[model samples]
Target chain A: MAKTIEEINEKIKAGKAVVVTAEEIIDLVKQKGTKKAAQEVDVVTTGTFSPMCSSGAYFNIGHTKPRIKLGGGRAYLNDVPAYTGFAATDILIGANALPDDDPRNRVHPGEFNYGGGHVIEELVSGKDIRLVATAYGTDCYPRKKLETWINIRDLNQAVLFNLRNAYQNYNVAVNLSDRTIYTYMGVLKPDLGNINYSSAGQLSPLLNDPYYKTIGIGTKIFLGGGIGFVAWQGTQHAPNVLRSDNGVPRRGAGTLAVIGDLKQMKPRWLIGTSMLGYGCTITVGIGVPIPILSEEILKYTAVSDEDIFAPVVDYSGAYPQMKSDILGEVSYAQLKSGMITIQGKEVPTASLSSYPRAVEIANLLKEWILSGKFQLTKPVAPLPGVESGITFKPLKERPIED
Target chain B: MVVSKRIVLHFPRRVVERPIVYRLVKDYDLEFNILKAFFTPEEEGLMVLELSGEQTDYDKGINYLTKAGVRIQSLSQDVIRNEERCTHCGACVTICPTGAFELDPLTRRINFYNEKCVACVLCIKACPPRAMEVHF
Candidate 1:
């Protein structure tokens, strides 16, 4: 029995939709099989809340008093650098942008605090931030310097227009070096002591919709606390990465660069952060709904942690080179168990990605979709596909070990 | 009783010559695990240690260090989270070894149970909001 989007929409309209989270849909498909589950289920919600480094927000702060025509000025938002290159009162903040005077090198991870990501979090939380800008005085709107505290409420337009985020799957990091290493994947101890991987696992948006069928441009999504849309193909949107038998990518593949209104966002869904010696990053709670239009789609949504595999990379070295020595393939189940044996030593594993929060986001999105409170947009365009060519080879040519 | 606690041991250059940790183990009959220890170029030292022993012995061990002029501060005083700064995103809930941070389930918010925390300092870095803080 095959399902169709039209029938699913009807079910949703009549308040008779059978919606299940990606995790629950897996069990449903396993018990009832894909055909039956596909016919019975209307929608499956998928979510991932992780520190996406490729995230940023654009703010049109509107005009300042005396209207500064600051063609080029130095702008600081709560001591963090803001991209004030453009005219008007517009500023862009990258998620990884660190404050000019960040004390990251001086202290350890927890103490070296605020950065651009933190500024975003504070804005989302409705907290005020010191906004300062200085420019060479222009005759049109001669105001050389202006300083004021601003909040999200006062901004004309505050929207999250990230270039890339929500990776299909990512590398698991471990350090083989002798000293402690600080990375975006948290602090890795010397000699492969601890392993850290970041992804929401089964609940991740890309994992649930592997081929980018239901998650393309214009798709309405849960961005932070509010509804958002996939504006365009994400940067480095690679779809040709090598895959396992189930179509799940073995490495980083398929990404979504999402956009959403800042006014509608809730503080709890977006947070800013600074890592010791690693700069800044923001954790975003994103949820996308995959309509169960057919048995094929249902099966895709049913992919679980045990079925998904990723390569462990040594971030202690540079990339492309890290691709040369693949540190064995392991499933999300193995990674989540908190331990993996590498080089005959028991290495503890930790996920920078939050599975608990991912599940919560999925469940919340499920309720939102089922209640007909959210609009599900059809894709305006498909993401990049296999035609683009795989960036690197993975898995297939594994040198048969002894 | 084999109870355990986390403490920071500071060794000023003047006290660096003293046998502070050795006496705690041998004389006070306490077990210690050094989470991390660092010596500055000036010879000042700061060590994060987990000390365990009978309740009376642990107290005596800590007292002995205070009298030796070795500053000791509890882990609870060092590892803290600013509730206002936290988004309750639960990023720390998954990385926490001792279940100190957990999901409320009903509210679906991450809650902090500081009592169960081991202060391994893992959550401090894992936290995306930078909400879980460590005070020196």
Candidate 2:
């Protein structure tokens, strides 16, 4: 018997909803079968905590006494440059933005101590941030320069609008070259010394709903330790990709563009990270609950680490050149075991994503649903799925022609 | 009574030219391994040494250095792992040369054994959250 989201909400309102985490659902379906488990479980919560580089926030700083027109001027938050091409007092800051004095990669493995991501985290933590803006004197707004300290509570609006996040699946990065290399995936030692991967595996949101059956635009989720929603299909979202026997994607595929009120978020869930030689990025914690509307949806939620596989890519040659060659494929189970055999040699593995934190977020979301503090919402529309016939395109470099 | 200790010796400028380490082996009958040493002609000299001998002899050797105006500090507490900042992401588990980091099988949490750490400082950069810090 299939259930509707409306019915699930009614059960949640009455405090009778049967909520389980993605980790728990794996065993539940195995013991009780999909048919019986689907009838019993109302929602399965999923979570991931990893570095999401394509994230940022927009803030509407209140107009100053003289009202500086910052739209055509320049603005900076904590010495980090912000995009001020919008209306006066409105500015956007990306997670990867660095200060003018940041040494960056000039020192080989640069230490990005602070950046836009740190500003966002400090803002969410209610710390006062220094805002500096310069503009040309105008009639309506004659202030040439203005500097002030602003807090999230004082801002007219602060919204976390990420372009891409919550990657469905990603590659396991390794190095085949004789020299050590530093990348966004972490440091890869020479001669396949170590492997680094970024994914929550079975507890990931999109992996639990491979085909986007229950996840889509306007889907409510736990973002940065606060309530948020899926705004759209994230940038570089490629649903049409190679898949395993099950519906899970074999490589990096689906992604989500999420939005939420930055004022309600916590600093712990949104951390500022410095990737050795790769500059800076923000580590975001996101949790999406999959409503079990049918047995198939329930089965998808039961996907385990052993069933999910990620391709091992050599970052030295293939990734830098945008080549499609891969070394081999390894399962999450093998990765979690702390070792995997690659090219006839046993290699150690590490994860950039925090699995323990992912589990905590999933359990917190489940508690919210069970206590009736949170309710599920049906997506207003579906995302482009496998049948969309969308192929991820590479950049075609062309010279300027008159 | 035999014991081994890794200690950092700071030689004051006045005693920089003295053979303080030679006395540990010749007079105190202790085995010494110098891990790192930096010295200038007229400046303070610094040396990280691992010394092993009888507990009484080790204590005497340290006393002899202290009397010579050389400051001694333990090397065990140099590298520190801040518990609040660590997310247990396991990035340090693989990069650490001495296997100082261990991931618990059940909890998936990283256990940092500072005793096994050689203060190589590799985990300092490998850690994304900057949880690992070296005081020296």
Candidate 3:
């Protein structure tokens, strides 16, 4: 029997008729339990949606103004803190890169010699918003000592406190475990001109030569592992940069563990969970210059890993979505296709391009659509440039080997 | 189930004193008493105490600390919102488990009455425009 809108909504809202069937639900409940039903829904929906949309992008479950988007990659596994220190450090850098040059860039008062970090500000043409990051300081320790310092309980408290201070200042936070960072370790010995993106017409001593200039906007320079770009050397500094990665510029041995930490650590105080394993670092780097010519110059390094499951702030840009189920059961049938709609009406989903959780949510939405269950309304007038932001390729599904 | 005999009220890192008639009330095995406590807000991470005692004991407790020139007042809600940054996105309106915020249907914004606020800051996380200011 064809179900009416009232009937379907009633069945769905009342939990009378199960969508997938009793046996499937029973099998899923047995395999993953009640807690994992939503996750299993994710896996199924993601598979169904890949053909419909792009990776790292989504038109949010219920609305469209701020398109639900995804960023970073999965890093922590099994509570075993991977990139524990590295994750915190990325937040430090990511927070520092805010458009506003706030003095609270450094986490610790005395940690960095300089008060303000180096800034990288780029206005990518046709891009949604300005991309920027600043570094307050750069200090290198034997990685072992760095790890040990992070493990100490008191030291950990102090670091979190200081990181919180930094986050508060920048109005940003980090999701430590679910942050996906692409790390390049032991990739360069600092001996080769291969990395020298300088636009010197003639090749001389690559290291000692201050004449080294990066390629202008037109020329293409190769970044190993299929990542190549017309790399332009930004403002240079005389400081000694680390250079000990394997020859494979992209496939360095070290792990770039993506964490779930928010770039801003303000959320930590409310969460009752004891922060056991978290680490951070903030390094000063010259702003990578974007060519006035092209947006394609924005290259994705092999270290580029996308985080598909982190919550993002609303269009207002204050905080991520709160965990309360404030919006009751708005049926999947009411979702519209082209216009990002919420509650059967089109509204901004907030540009979620930089959000880490948009992909997962979008995938869920697509599955709900494909099942022939939703009443989708396509926008009468298509939103300009909205379609281009969706990344088509998704990360290959991680197979669960029996 | 563990019965909680006492609870420590830190009182915003401040010290205060009061000598008033009080009674220890048992609400579901948890004992709560209104008594004079000491707090010094000037010092960071200071402790505030609430004593469970009789009228004479309360007087004695107040007398013990009154000489120290402690101020006394009812606990006030911590003001977390920064007036300058608050765009009032109605996030706090949706997040407050208590009906602390009432939206102006005309403006589509929130009116925060702190008396009703439980200080949960769920709205702080929900305010994506970066509006919620936390004094804490």
Best by TM-score: 2
User: Which is better, 1 or 3, measured by TM-score?
Assistant: 1
Tell me the interface RMSD of every candidate, in Å.
4.6, 0.7, 15.5
For residues A1-402, write the lDDT of model 1, one tens digit per residue: 665566677777788888889989878888998888888888999888888888889898888778885457888888888887777678898887777776666765434466777788789889998988888877677788989999899899999988888988998888877887777777777788778888878889998888887778888899998899998878777888778888899888888889999889887778776655577788888999998877788889999989999988887774435445777788888887756888899876766776777888899998887787764667878876667664544446768799
The estimated TM-scores of all candidates read 0.82, 0.97, 0.25
lDDT by residue for model 3 over A76-182, one digit each (tens)?
Answer: 11112222223223312221221222223243211111111111011001112211212222232212112111211111221111111100000011122222211
Model 2 CA deviation exceeding 4 Å by range:
B13-17, B36-46
RMSD of 1: 6.4
Chain B TM-score for candidate 2: 0.88
* Model 2, native contacts kept: 0.79
Better of 1 and 2 by lDDT: 2
**How far off is residue A42 in model 1, in Å?**
0.8
| Cα error of candidate 2 at position B92, Å | 1.1
Error of 3 at A178 (Å): 20
**lDDT per residue as tens, model 2, A74-189:** 98999999998999888999999999999998979888878888889899999999998899979999999988899999999999999999999999999999998999999899
Give each model's whole-structure lDDT: 0.80, 0.93, 0.23
